[model samples]
Target chain A: MSGLLDVEGLVTRFYTEEGVVKAVDGNSFRLEEDEALGVVGESGSGKTVTALSIMRLIEAPGRIEAGRILFRGEDLLKKSEREMRRIRGKDLSMVFQDSLSSLNPTLTVGAQIARVLKHHTRLSRRARWRRAVELLAAVGIPEPAKRASHYPHQLSGGMRQRALIAMAISCNPKLLILDEPTTALDVTIEAQIFELIGELKEEFGMGVFLITHDLSVVASFCSRVIIMYAGKIVEEAGVHELYAHPLHPYTRGLLRSIPPLEGGEARLQSIPGEVPDLINLPPGCNFSPRCALADERCWQVEPELSGITPGHRAACWRAERPAMAGGGHD
Target chain B: MIVFLSKRLLLAIPTLLVASFLIFSLVHIAPGDPIQVMLGDFQDPELIARLRHEMGLDLPLLQQYFHWLGNIVRGDLGISITVQRGASVTDLILQRFAVTVELAFFSLIIALLIAIPTGIISALRQNKLSDHLSRIIALLGVSIPNFFLGILLILFVGVYLRKPWGAGGYVPLSRGLLKNLAHMFLPAVALGTAYAAIIMRMMRSAMLDAMSQDFVRTARAMGIAPADIVRRDIVKNALIPVVTVIGNSIGYLLGGSIVTETVFRLPGMGNLVIMGVFRRDFPVIQAVVLIIVVVRIAVNLIVDLTYGFLDPRIRYGGER
Candidate 1:
């Protein structure tokens, strides 16, 4: 009853040409009903895979190696693809990043929305059509009925995103997976998207597994946050707790990377180097090669995720006494 | 779309011109004189030389090409070197063209009908028993030469089935439609096999790729059924690529079906060209080659237009 979604030790990999990419290593988290949890990381930090894995949308060459995706205490991984399809768009749904490409270009938005209502709910044609318009309006699409008749290509990017949001929230699923849902928009449009997600969450009581590479979005919108690096969770804590006392160096690096508005200039620090390639990953801590405090222990054996606070976890040898950062330590 | 097409067309012009020149020059280049070949070796040398000179073989190669090009621009293809009742090359072209067109057209229909569904099913259940079996079938279709397949089909359907089912021979669609299909089946299968493999492989891969796209995943996530996913989402997205392969294969269908046509004793352009080549009927060969070239060019133009229709993103005017 307490946790609406409990994911533990989720592991995913892909047999790619380069090698077997350990895209998502062991990671665990929980969300209360209607709670918004943010997953933050740079590109290739297992952020998208974790979101896709949650949606059960990981394609061939990539699969759920081992994991327990418990949705309201039921193991989702064990469900048949058929049963999973039933839950998708009803019990759980995902809002993908490429909003324009994510929509079927040939299908009218109304028909697309009507399909879910038809499949998941026993609504009459007229009633479902009415509900589609309402959902479109709820997502702030102007001229709901008129715009609904248009194909995805006819709508602007922002409108297409809203359509996707409308579709995701159509069934009022228990969990909504948003994988950089606002990444494709401009800053001005980005604000509108965040506001939409916020409004939709309040209107419909549902868990939101919001995946994004932008730390600022997580800082502003997420109740709890998980910071990942090199396919594994490096840090997890309540948003305020992590912001007040960031434990992992990678977390500290990421927070420092974000420039503070109305204040610091050279304070923002870009973490040196990219996310380590998952294929042929280094021994010990995957982040050790990039870590400033890499030592014999950090380089010899991997640090297990250990509790730094009641619920906050950090996988670092120096988790207890990590250096504090200047407001914008660029 | 226009930019891609203009570039392709600009390239095609040189190609057609070259093909036309080659066909014309082929008559002159052959060891025997064209007039002698037409009038036979018994004709006097002076009359043979006079006929060749009149036919313009005595002109320079470049002059011959320019004269041919000029005539082509005026909608004229010179008289046939050997033919009945003094029919112009163009007239003979029109007369024989229908039979070839009908054969190629029927073969193309057979190819699409067999290939598309097989490809879809193969992709939908990839690596399963049916899929593996389909792969085997498609492989056999690919490996066995089309002419040989055509001969077998004639034996089985035309000879064997005809004995049991009644005497078999082609009835044009304009004739009794049902009987026409029955008569055409052997030739169609023979001509269609090569293209069938190509279409099947392209469709299967394209369908597989389309099924993996986010839009299709979104479609399924929206609770659309699997069959509908294939029809609406997967196959639709897969078409642009599939169309390209199919368009290219049509050339093989029309021009390359020569062996199949010969085996089935069908009167297609392939058979015409083969006969013309052997008998040294210079004008017939030239006319047939030119017509095939033009048909290929026209088919390509249609394919280009089709792209714009299928995807609005494709602009036929220019890159802009």
Candidate 2:
């Protein structure tokens, strides 16, 4: 079956005065319906840019140079802005990271939710408000009626996030793109938010495009994962497969960086060196500067994402070597 | 809210007292003598002394201040010294204040009507030709003096066009609303243009800030119509800061109306105060200045209250 979202050879760039920043260089991924697919990367790794490209929300200074985002087998790029407007909140919705800033300060949380319903649904004003309050309650907010009248600042961080989620899911979108949705929340709230999203995915049967820097978050919440580096995907595999046998050296570094649950003398390992500047990236693989296993060939030529074990892929020339198959963990 | 309001009102008392004291002392210290101006070329020392005694100007400065303060507290603004001898300063102010209030009110309306839409458009289409045009217009509005603009308006609309309502004059509201508006419109435009420029630039920057905020992105991502996003997300949030600018500018508007009123030949507080200053009408000057200070205080209070209304995070006196 065709996937719910298929991004093909996407290249998004920002034309700044400095240079053209290849924010999301040529990369592609697919997300199945009702499946949770996580995009893992450190900051400036083009994960957010990929999601924005799909949403077609890239503004001036940034342009989707070349891409085909197929949603439900229809080319979204081919759709008119007016048609895209109808499809956006109804068929696709996005929840941003900063809940407080993501919600309008001047409007009550419910009124903001009702606004989405106002455009997407034919519900009456009163009915939209009622539905908004209902959505709030469904998102686990207490005293839905009273909370509906409260502005975003009046609510706690978790509650505000819940309000944002309620707004995103108000129209019952088929695909929900959550960009670092729990990054601003505490650990406990983060777990609860993911749990809520998991439940909502099942309830709504919505495919989730979960983007985060945290490997553990994807490990817990996503069934399939794609690890991105700089502006390209470095690895793609099933959650268990990726965790047990991460093919890419960058992915291995990420997996090793996750602190073990049982506290021991093992210090958390960090991937050394910063994300490369997109405007002036080094020759060969973007990760070569930081990869310990990077050889002469790795510095001279970039590698394409090639299948290793069936269903597992990595864009590393060294991944095919038998000695590296064990997936280093110390 | 009530507690906050009452506290602010109580604070105004001390402020008004200080302002009144300053006005009284300054007027008394100034070289011009109302009696001398009133009895021009007469050279009657005995009459001047008797008149000064009757007016209680011969009393000690502190005594005079206390006496005037006492009368002010009792809602008595005293009699005009020379501008209109024996006429109640309170009555004179009341008559002239009506005209100024109308002028200021209409000017504000004109200002908002011009500033808001243009501000939104300018911000929405930033760096575009329309935006550039609006910015140029706003710059002109700011750069050109109101009196000079007033003269240009008179030259264009009054002399060149030869329209009956184009010339400088005041029409009482009692005559008719349209006639009153027509007479007030040009002066209002003259006074308002500068404020419009100020408010427009404020609104433009504020809108730009609002547009770049995360909430606006969320609104757009939700597929809310572009118009709706602009209205609800951008404009609504943008108005908060712009309201503050508008509130602060109201004081400027009232002050600016002085020149605007003079140019337009309107019998407003500006004209009254000018006459008072020239004649050294102490009571008239003191009362008019006092009223202005009070009006400014009241406007500031209103602005503060509006903050709570605009942004829900602002709760007066910590009330939920």
Candidate 3:
């Protein structure tokens, strides 16, 4: 009957030479129990930083300057480093990007997985070993019992990602954050990963936070979609509704940018102007500079996330009702 | 692997030849002759000529180098002029070289004891008071010459502890391990303290670098205990660079121990070389230098092989 995670007014900034760069500026969202939310954005939209801030993995010069991240109603920002560490594995886990670099190169897959078990469970050595093998098998690695004994280098990109997944889900965490989960793999492996996630999500009803730039993935698996721009959520709605009727200019632009495959020409449309620099940003709206329908009001006023319908929001001054058909201006 | 060895081997030939050339030239070019130093108080010019002729001092420079190289290849480094019926330079080195090895072994042990924990703590608490304190300690070690530190340690041990500095002679490690260890501690520590500082600083930097790697974050996300992260994740990855520093430290220790030995009044290889330098004993100096070079090379090769064990990503010949 309630949300598994509730992040509100989350503002993260990096103290740099020029000025504070608001990496995640007053962004907020939530995931209900057993829900999967996809975050789609261009680079510098604070996609990764938002995920990192939730995990309390922000390093020096960069820190959560304001806001609350409530996991199961416990304020995560107030937790001690040690406490946050415990929550990271036991409650919320992350399947990191770049499995080649994410997996410890020195340790075997089994040893790496065993470490997760060791952290959250008080299992004996034998129990940990068996559990590591079982987790590896669950992730669909071939000869898992033996494969777990091999180091990260011995595995291909897909296998390394599976090992990362095995480690992430080891504790049956309430939430799993997959940052660009299938972005590094080929189509077949990507399909395997989507299917594996489906299987695991069914087995353990953990909420999923999928962060990627791929719009297709949101269409495929996400229950809800949150579109971000310049470190702020511009639009949020159910996956079906958002794709069919993206109200925010940025979201509409992104949807139209995906090229089609066929005999016809595939030239896609794109929004002009790069993402606004977080440091020394122009005052009012960040996306206003690139907006097509910008007015004096758009440049002078900061648009807050406002509901256009129940459970749907868009931070746009000129948002209109979506057409009944798939998203289009006609 | 063979290619690497061949490369190392080809590189070593030039290195060894350059060393041989320098030692041979400096000894010959210097004003005083070894014959004069050996037959001191001899104003007789005829005896000097006879001795110089017998030792092949009359040969041209290039001829002498080839002759020496040929003999060295045949395992006959020229006989020691100082010691009567002077043993082959290699044999004399082998006998005395063990003492230096034993001392270096103790130094490495002492260095490890001081470095590993200090470095790990420094990196784990990076930029905190303890980390600053460790940095200060390392800086002081780097700033102050080891010879000054050596002298200070000897004085501290003598004026305060009331332990005799050079009264007990050397005890062979094989005959009595405990006695040998106790006897070597003061000198070894004097030599090892600098190495410890070096290794500690290198390890701290390496661990700091490793700590920032993605897998380290991955390990943290796995909720691995801080201690386990330091041990299994941080240290394991950090070890490669540390090994390189320590391998290089071996050369520093053996080369620098000469001054420390002089300060402590010990009869180690350093002291022996200093004595040979005063007496102008070319054979003993060459033998000592050669032994130091070979031992350093051995340590480096051992370090290279160790890299294979430390990181699976590093293979001897790399991946096919």
Candidate 4:
């Protein structure tokens, strides 16, 4: 059976003055209904680009060259702009990272939420406003009626983010793409946001495409996760299994880099090199230059993301061999 | 808001005082003497001195300033010495100011009508043919001087087309609205084109900025219609900065009206001030300049108040 979201062979590129930046190159993934799929990637690793591509929001100079974004058994890539718009915010919605920038400063929080309802539903203006307040209340905001009339700047950071979430779920979308939804909040607020997302997911039965760089966040919140590097998916697997045995070296490095809560090494382990420039990436594996086990063969040929275990996949020539000693341990 | 308004108004008293003092001092400090200009070839020292005493010009400069200030407090703006000899400066200014206000209002309407739509279109279609065309038009608008544009309009519409209303003149509102508008149209265009260019460029940049804002992307991601996104998200946000530019440029419009009035032969404040300067009519010049200063302060206050209306984040008084 098909999942709620199945992205196949997605190739998004930006044709800039310097060169064509392969932002998302031949990545494929599936998100089951009512499941939280975490997309973990560093900056410029095509996490946001992948989300934007799914939304068909790539502007000029940045085009989705190839992709089949199948949403709910319907190919979203094949839909027209009008059809895509109707599907967006109704069947599919997205929440951004920076709530302050994402919410219109000039418009009240309630009005912004009401606006989404205005377009997506047949509710009257008053009803839309009432529903907007209800959504705000549902998102754990205090005094929803009074808070709805307040502008984005008037609210605290956490509240603004909640308001944004309220807007995203205003129409009860089947798939909600959250791009680092709580990255700007404090740790406590971040945990609260995830809890709210968890509640909202259960309430709406929505598939969440949660994109972030925080692996711990993904481990705690997502059932499955994909690790992206240099605009490519380096690994994909169940969260628990992947954490127990991270097959790829880059994934191992990311896993090891997370600081231990109690007694451990004073310094955190980090990947050796910078993410390769998309325009002039290494000929072989994108992370080969940074891989300690990279040999002549690894440097000459790029590996396809192939199945290693029953439900785990990794794109590394070394993954076929036994797990490297002294690695994958916190 | 009331507290803000009252504070701004109270602050204006000192500003107006400084402005009035500068007007009085500068007009006095200038070389030309009103008595000499009025008497002309009849340069009798005794008669000139007598007239000077009668007008209080012979008094100590400080005392004369106070006398003038005292008269202004009583709604007296002194008498015009040369432009309209012995005419009450207050009545003369009121008549001319009405014409100037009507002209300025018409120009503002014309400028906004042309600038806003074109600016939005230009920004929406940036780097397109329409955008280039508008940019070119704006450049031409700024390049051509107001007097030259006015004369060109008169030549084209009056001399070439032979339209009765195209010739330089003014018609009172009582004459007929259409006739008055027809007469005011060319002058307004000439005075407004340059302002339209400035505002259009500002609007274009502001719109471009607003378009790139994250909120606009959020609106799009939420499935808001493209037109609604442009209207509700982009345009409203863009208008905030553009309103500031419009407020700041009102002074430019009033200043440009001087040349426009001269070319169009309208008896507005510009013409009155110009004639005042040429004939050393200190009362007319000083009164007109002082009024312009006061109007500028009031416009600024209105602009500040408008910010509260446009963006709720900008709270005034203790409500913040």
Predicted candidate 1 versus true structure: per-residue lDDT over B62-178, tens digit per residue: 897788779887988777665442568777666667767777887788888888999999999988998899778888988888877876766776577764222323456677777
lDDT at residue B100 of model 2 (Cα atoms) = 97
Question: Between prediction 1 and prediction 2, which has the larger lDDT?
Answer: 2
Model 3: clashing residue pairs?
A: none
Kindly indicate the candidate among 2 and 3 with the higher lDDT. 2
Whole-model lDDT for model 1 versus the true structure?
0.82
The alpha-carbon deviation from the true structure for residue A68 of candidate 1, after best TM-score superposition, in angstroms, is 3.3
Q: Is the docking of candidate 3 incorrect, acceptable, medium or high quality?
A: medium
Over 4 Å off in model 1, which ranges?
A: A13-22, A65-67, A123-134, A143-146, A149-154, A262-267, A272-289, A293-307, A321-330, B1-33, B53-78, B88-91, B155-175, B315-320
Question: Whose DockQ is higher: candidate 2's or candidate 3's?
Answer: 2
Worst 10 residues of 2 chain A by lDDT: A321-330
Best by DockQ: 2
Clashes counted in candidate 2 amount to 0
lDDT of 2 at A122: 94
Tens-place lDDT per residue, model 2, A111-133, is 99999999999999999999999
Candidate 2 lDDT tens digits, B1-320? 88898999999999998999999999999996798899999969999999989888899999999999999999999999888999999999989999999999998999999999999999999999999999999999999999999999999999999987789999898999999999998999999999899999999999999999999889888999999998889998999999888888788988888888999999999889988999999999999989988999899889989987998889898866
Model 3 share of native interface contacts: 0.71
lDDT of 3: 0.84
Better of 1 and 3 by TM-score: 3
